[model samples]
Each structure stands twice: as C-alpha cells, then as structure tokens.
Target chain A: MSSLAVGCRLRVAVLVLALLGAGAVGGGSTAHAADDGELTLDSIVNNVIVGHAEDGNYLNFDPFATVELPRIMVARTADGALTVDLYGSTKGLLKDGTYGLVPHSEGEGGHEEVITESSALQEAFASKAHLHGDIVRTSGHVVADLSITRHLIFGLLAMGIVLAIFLVLAQRYKRGVGRTEAPHGVLQNMMEVMVVFIRDEVAKPNIQGEKWRTFLPYLLSAFFFILMANILGLVPYAGAATSNIAVTGVLAVMTFVIGLLYGSKDHYKHMFLGPPDAPWPIRVILVPIELIGTVMRHLALAIRLFANMMGGSLIIFSLIGLVFIMNVLFGEAMAFGTSIISIGFTVFILLLKLLVAFIQAYVFTILSALFIGISVEEHEHEEHADDAHAEAPTSQTSGALSDRLDAVDDAVDDVTEPAPA
Target chain B: MTEVIAQSLVQPDVGLIFWKTIAFLIFLFLLYRYGWGPITEAMESREEEIESSIQRAEEALAEAKEIQSENKKARREAEREAQRILREARESAEELREEEMAKTRDRIQQMQEQAQAEIEREKQAALQELRDEVADLAIEAASKVVRDDLDGERQRKLVNDFIDDLPKN
Candidate 1:
C-alpha cells in the first residue's frame, strides 16, 4: 500500500513537472503573440499536428512542451558518394552547416506558414530545397532522411512491447505451458483467447479453407500490432503509429499485395470479365467498375484506420487548446474557469478514444481478412455447377452431405418461417 | 486554421513510411516465426487434446456402463439358479419323510399279528391238559370197586370189557 502511494506520488510529480515545462513554452509564445497582435488558431493546429519527420518536436500530454527526437539524414555529397549525417537533436542539426531549419511564414495561413517564414527560407524553398522541418539542399540531394522521429520511436516502442509479450508467450508454448494442460494465469489465457479468436472468429469465417492457416500469422500480427499502437497512443507521452497515414498505407498495401498475388483465377476473372453469364455490354461496364471498386476498397481500409486514430487525438487536443485560447481572450480567471469544462470534455473524448482504439483495430483486421478471403475464395465454375447439380441426388445418400443439406435447410427455414400465431 | 490542419492531416513523409514499413515488416516476420506460429499451434493442439480427452472419457464411461449391465445380468442368473437348487432340495427332503412314516406303520402291524398268534396257541394247549385229567380219575374209581368183589382173574376180565365197550361207544 505504501509502495502504491509512493508510485502515485511519483506520477503526480511527473505530471506537475510536465505541466510546468508546458507552461513555460506557452508563456514564452506571448512574445510572438505580441508581434502578431494576438495568438491565432494556427499555433494550436501546429501544436496538435505531427509536422514532419525531420522535425524533432513531439507532441506530449502537456500540449505545449515538445520532446526533440534524434535527426538522421543521408545526403549525397558532391562526389556522388553517400554520406550519413547524424545529430543528437534537431537543434544540433541546425548548428551543423549541411542543413538549416526553414522559417515558418507568419501570415500565409497554412502549415507551411505556421512558423514565420523569412526571405532566406523563401529563397531556399524557391531553390527546390526540401523544407520538411529540416532543409535539404536541392542541388546535392539527400538519398533518404531515415531520421528517428517521435512517431518512429513510438512505433518501435510499440513493436518492442508486442515482441516482448509474444516472445515470452512463444517460449511458454515451447515449454508446453498451454499445450498439454489448461492455460494458467491472465497473460497466458489472454494470449490464448486472442489467438483462438483471430483463428476461429476472424480468419476461419472470412478466409476459409486451408488457406486461413497461411494468412493466420499475418492476420494475428496485424491485429496485435494495431491494438498495441492504439493503446499506447492513449498513454500520456506515447503516439499512435496507426494514426499516421503512411503506416496504415503500408499495412493496406500489404493486404492488397497479398490479395493480388494469391488471388484465384476466378477472382481476377470475376473482376475483369464480370460473371460469365452476363451480357457482353454489361460485362464491359461492370469490369471497370469492379476494378475501381477493388482499388477503392484497399484505399478506404488505409484511410479508415488512419483517420479514426488521428481524429480521436485531434479532438482531445482541440479541447485542451480551448483552455489556452480562453486564457488569451478572457484573461486568467476566465481561462481558469474554462479549464474545468475543457478538461471535462477532454476526459470524455479520451474515454471514447480508448474504445475507438480497439474498434478500429478490429475493423482493420477483419476487413483485411474479408478482402483476402474474397481474393482466395474457391468457387465452382458454371460447368462444375451443372455437374454438381446432376450429382446432387446421388450425393444426398452420403451422411455428411445429407447433414450439411439439413443444416442449410434448417437455416433457410428459419429465414423463411413466419411468426407463430 | 483549416489549411494548417489540412497540411498536418495530409502530409506524408517518405522517411516515416520507409521506417514504418521496415519496422512493421520486421515485427510481422519475427512474430510470425516465433510468436504467432507457436502460439496458434499450441492452441490448436490444446483444443485437439481437450476434444480427444473428452471423447476418451465418453468411451470409458460407455465401457463401464456396459460392464455394469453385464455384471447385473450374471448376478440375476446366479440368483435364479440358487432359488432352483433350494427348491429341489426342499422337495427331496419332503419325499424322504413320507417313506420313513410308511416303514414305521408296517413294523407295528407285524408285531401285533405275532402277539395274537402266541395267545391262541397257548389257549389250545391248556384245554387239552384238562380233558386228560378227567379221564384219569374216572378209570381209577372203576378199578377199586372191581377188586373188592372178585379175585385177580375176574378183575382183569372186567377192565378189558370196559375198554371194549368204550371203543364201541
């Protein structure tokens, strides 16, 4: 009990420290605010957004104070050989001569202008120097800025956590923890339940046949990864990797690739030629529509996950930003009063976000399964269909076939049955 | 504000994508190999074990039930056989008792007959003895009278005459 109290005290202390640090940054912005006549909404938006990969600034729970991540850039030198530049932080990169921070434009009223842009910055922008948080000289271009950003750090952290959990679970399984006997303890049981759920509920129902085994590993990994990332984001100082479009894009692309690569001939035939029974004119029209629809589905999968995660965080940030906005507009007393209302809404959204996190992960995983299922589905062709119909009566003598037919009949009867008098 | 928000929302950096893809793929591969593969396999095996164990238990229960029924049938048959043996024993015992009673009745009848026969034989013998005595007394009286009247020759002739007259009567 005493240890618990001490832990709570430590958390409170850290929260207080974070708030103080944020307050300093927020107060320091008043100098810029004085020049701009007043603090605009742009600052709040900028604070909420993850600006660029090269930007060392990370959005923390405190809202104002940002954590700087390490900057890494691979630039091509004049000799055409690759050179890697490493800095402890973005500030260190600015101190180095190879790259410079592009100035933010004050009145241009966009993310490009969120930071006051100087003439020198405009010149750099004209010269085609990439101004993504850090300037890369357009003449001697950088191969890739594989810098470790805040999101990347969080992403890796999420991966590390997932790996740690599963690796232990794997070891336990190797030692026959859940194999020969009933699984004991919360962790083992939880892992078993999730694995079973994904296999039985998600993969089996969607991706049917023996093929489910092939995709089960990928599906399980995607589900756990997304779930972990979403939950991590809800923590005080962590970010949701799925909130980034790029991450979701990569995930969606993987699903698309799997579908494209492993799709049955019938799958492609259906998409490209429509149903064989359809008229030629109708088939031609349907083919392009189906093709577009397939692409759109994949795109939607990525966007849906990304938007849901991003939107939840955005709402929470906007709610907290209201308190600061009130402080600027109505003085300290009104701002203090508004903090209660703002915090109330923020907490409410936070709870909703927690639910959304699980739901989005589920939605993403199930949809991927569905898409893969459709691609890999085996269907009896028209000729085979006729043959099956001819053989149906004879096949009915088999007990298994008859039982299956009975089940189907029962399902049909249930659907068609009227209300009892 | 909208432009700033839009830029933030829409911006995608190559570096982040590249890193994310790499990290995610690595995670997927590592977990697929070590984590998910073994875990799923374990769960599948566990399910199969449970199912087989239940089936085995059911089979054992059925066998036990079958054995119990067979035992009951044998016990019933043994009970019936014992009842039949007891009944046959009781019937033989009753027959033996009746035979002993008949033998005792025949022995009593034989003894009574023997006793009656002896009594009759004795009566006949006594009767004969009485008759002989009477005869002897009569003869003696007749001889005394004769001796007083005549001489020895005349007495002999009178006794012979009396024996002859008795023979004729």
Candidate 2:
C-alpha cells in the first residue's frame, strides 16, 4: 500500500515537473510579452511576424509560435489557374491588416498581402469551397507532413521487420538448424509454446479437421498484424492506424469476406433461413434475428478495435490538456499538483493501452475464428432429417425426435466425410 | 479573371488516397508470410517435446521399479534357499548325535549284564568247594571216635545220613 502511494506520488511529481518545464520554456520565450504586444496562447497558435521601419524597414524574422498542425493551402479551380487564400489570423497577417504572400508578386512590393479580408471574404468562407473549371479553393491547417506520414509507415515497417525476424528464428528452431537438437534459446522456446497453444487451444477447438489448418494462416496473420499495429500506436508520435475507422472497417470486411468464402452452406442457411433444429415457430422469429446478429457481430469487431485505440489516445490527450488548464487557473503550484495527477493518469492509460492492444487483437482473431466455425458448422438435425427421409418414410413427422436423430446423423456425417474437393 | 482564379483552390483528399489500400495489402501479405507461421509451429513442437520427455521419464521410472522388485524377489528366494540348506544341515547333525547316544547306551547295558553274570558264577563255585571240605573233616572226626570205642557204628551212621542227604539234593 505504501509502495502504491509512493508510486502515485512519484507519478504526480513527474507530471508536475513536465508541466513546469513546458511552462518555463514557454515563459522564457515570452518574458517580454508586454513590449512585444503578444502574450496569449491564441496568438502563439495564430503565430505573428514583426517588421520595423528602423534599419531601412528590414523584416524581423521570428515565428511567434508553431502549431502541432501544418498550414493547409487549398487551390481553387478557375480558368486562370489555382490560387489559395489564407484566412483568419496567422503569422502571415501584417499589423496593417494585410496578408503576406509566400513569394512576392512580381515586384508588387515586398511583404504584400495578396488577399485581404472583407465582406466578400466572410461570404466565401461560409460556403464549402468549390472546385470548378481549373480553379478550386480550400484551405485548412495541414496537420501532417510527408515526414510524419513516413514515420507512420516506418512504424508499421519496423513491426513487420520484428515479426519477420521472429519467424526466421522460429523456423530455424523448428528445423534444428545450426544445432544438433532443438534450440534452447528463450525466443525459440517461447515461439514453440505459442505455436502449439494456438494450434491446440485456438485453431483445433474452433476450426475443424484438415480445414482448420487451411484457415490457420489467416487467423494467425490477423492476430499478429493487428497486435503489432496496436502496440506501435502506443508509442509517442506514432499514429494509431488501427484506431482509424477505415482501417478497422477494412479488417472487419476482410473477415466477413473470408467467412463468406470458406463458410459452408449450412452457415448461411441456418443463420438466415433458420436451422432445422429450431421449431417452426422459433425459427420464424430467430432466422431474422440470427441474420441481423451476423451483421452486428462483424460490426462490433470494427467498433471494438477502433474504439479501444482511439479511446486511449483521447484519454491521454485530455490528461495533458488538464495540466495546461490547471496552470492557467491556479498558477504554478496548483498546476504542479494537477500535473502529477494527470501524468499519473496518462502513465496508467499507457499501460492499459498496451493490454488493450493485445486483448483487442485476440478478440478480433477469436471472433473471426468463431464466425468461420459457425459458417461451416453442419446442422446435425438437417443431416439427420435427410438420413431419416432416406431410411424411414414416416420418421420426419416426429418433429423434435426426428430433429434430434437428424442432428446425430449429421454429426456422424461431418466426422466421416472427407475434405470436400 | 486572373484575380478570381487565384482566389480558390481545392484540398486534395489525402485520406482517400488509394495508397492506403496498397500499403494495407503489402502489410498484410508481409505479416502473413514472415510472422505467424513459424512462431506457432515452434510453440507447438516445444510442447510436444516436453510432453514426450515426461512420458519417457515416467516409462523409465516404471521400468526401474520393475527391475528393483525383481531384484528383491530374487534376493528373497536366494535367502530362503540358504535358510533351507542350513535347516537341513542342523537336522542331520541332530540325527547323528541321537544315533551315537543310543549306541552308547546299548553297549553300557550289555557290559553291566556280563559283569553280573561273572560275579554270580564265581560265588557258586566258591560255595561248592566249601561244602566239600566241611564234609571231609566231619568224616575223619567220626572215624577217630569209632576207633576209640564204637567208631565203626558212628562212621556207618554218618555215612548213611550223608547218603540220604545227597539223594535229597
């Protein structure tokens, strides 16, 4: 208990230190805010540029502040060519109520504003920018750059490399390469156990016979891919690709497709048209329910992965925001107190994020397996009914009894039948 | 027209880029190919090896137990055989001692009987010799008395009595 309290205290202390450090860095730069006529966080977010008439009116080049996002320049479509206009307050805006162009317009004076704010500008900004002819206009802060995107790609690539290395080592261990017997390395041993566990505990139970192996590759692939992606996202500056709805949606769709392709007729017929085992009245209500359920299950898969990753990031962001808010309201001392709490929460969330990553991956893989299993499941009652029809003409009328008998027969058939060609 | 054209531009839908799909496909393929297969297989084989090793150890233990039991039985059997041999030897020695004691008793009984017979024979001979000597003395004394007086009559009387007594014996 004492240890826990101490840990909590330490976390709070760290948060406070981080908050103070940020405040110090920011404060030192803005020490002369009165003289500079800039002090607020909003001004920093907007950025500013200064110029002096002294020294032959030379430009004072200093960015007031840089935002986390980049400025987005959207081009408009028109016959003359595309042109982008900057709006709102930014570093490019001059003190004389004008905007600066990136490249001076053909000697239109240095630091000249290409587009000025006016009544027409307000109207233009209200409507979604149009793309017509050769000109189209749209602009926003470009939060990501090529480097950021590359970093994300690199994160994914690094995970792939790690997985590849593990595979190579595992394969070598399996083949007994470079050793007289199975390698005793920790990695080799761990891999061996996981392989066996997945085969027996996961694949064997949920998947049937020779067919199980056929689907094993996809299931395993999904598991590791999602798992690695989730873990990578937890790293600082690494974007959670899986957190993106589109990414999770694509994976869910893939699972759905596999379920469709590999699933036996019984899956669709039983789920959609009602299983033979169900009573007529029950089937009437259940078939639709089951069909809807199938859709919901896959949908849930998408939401689960997306929500888990996205939720973790949002929580961390909120915690960080809390520190800044505290600093603004209660000054440095109270900010430190709050910073500790926030940072501790952030750390806790980070740990949980790690666990959630693995769990979500497992859940996705297992659910996918379940779907595949369900799809291919043979309705014993149906098979038994068929057999009863063949063996005894009156056997189908017994309803419940016949259903049970048919189920037995179907199960037997499932076991006896060879893999379909 | 140029001023109007310069005023507007459209943002590119980078989010909707087809490159995402391409990247996703590449990632999935690479991950499938290199990552999951061997790890799973390795884990499985490791478990199999451990299970088999345990089974082998158990079998060896059972075999060892069997050998030990067999050894114990053999040792017991050998001990029992040795005891049986000792018992037989002891019984034989006892029988030999009994036989020797019985022979010694018989010999002593025979010697005692022979000695009694010898003593009885000697006593009978002595008695017979004494009676003969006494009879001779009495006859001589009777002859002297008859010569002095009616010695013939006395000697005749004594001889007659002796003859009667001899006839009775």
Q: State each candidate's chain A TM-score.
A: 0.74, 0.57
Please give the lDDT score at residue B17 for candidate 2.
Answer: 27
**lDDT per residue as tens, model 2, A170-258:** 46755754233556677666655554555666667666556777777777666766777778767654546666555677778788888
Residue-by-residue lDDT tens digits, candidate 1, A206-299: 7758899999888988998898988887887777888888788889999999999999887787779775556799999989988997898789
Question: Which 10 consecutive positions of candidate 1 chain A have the poorest summed lDDT?
Answer: A412-421
| Per-candidate clashes, comma-separated | 5, 31
> Best candidate per TM-score, number?
1
State, as a TM-score between 0 and 1, how close model 2 is to the true structure: 0.56
- Give candidate 1 regions above 4 Å deviation: A1-40, A48-67, A76-83, A109-134, A381-421, B109-169
Q: Label model 1 with its docking quality class.
A: acceptable
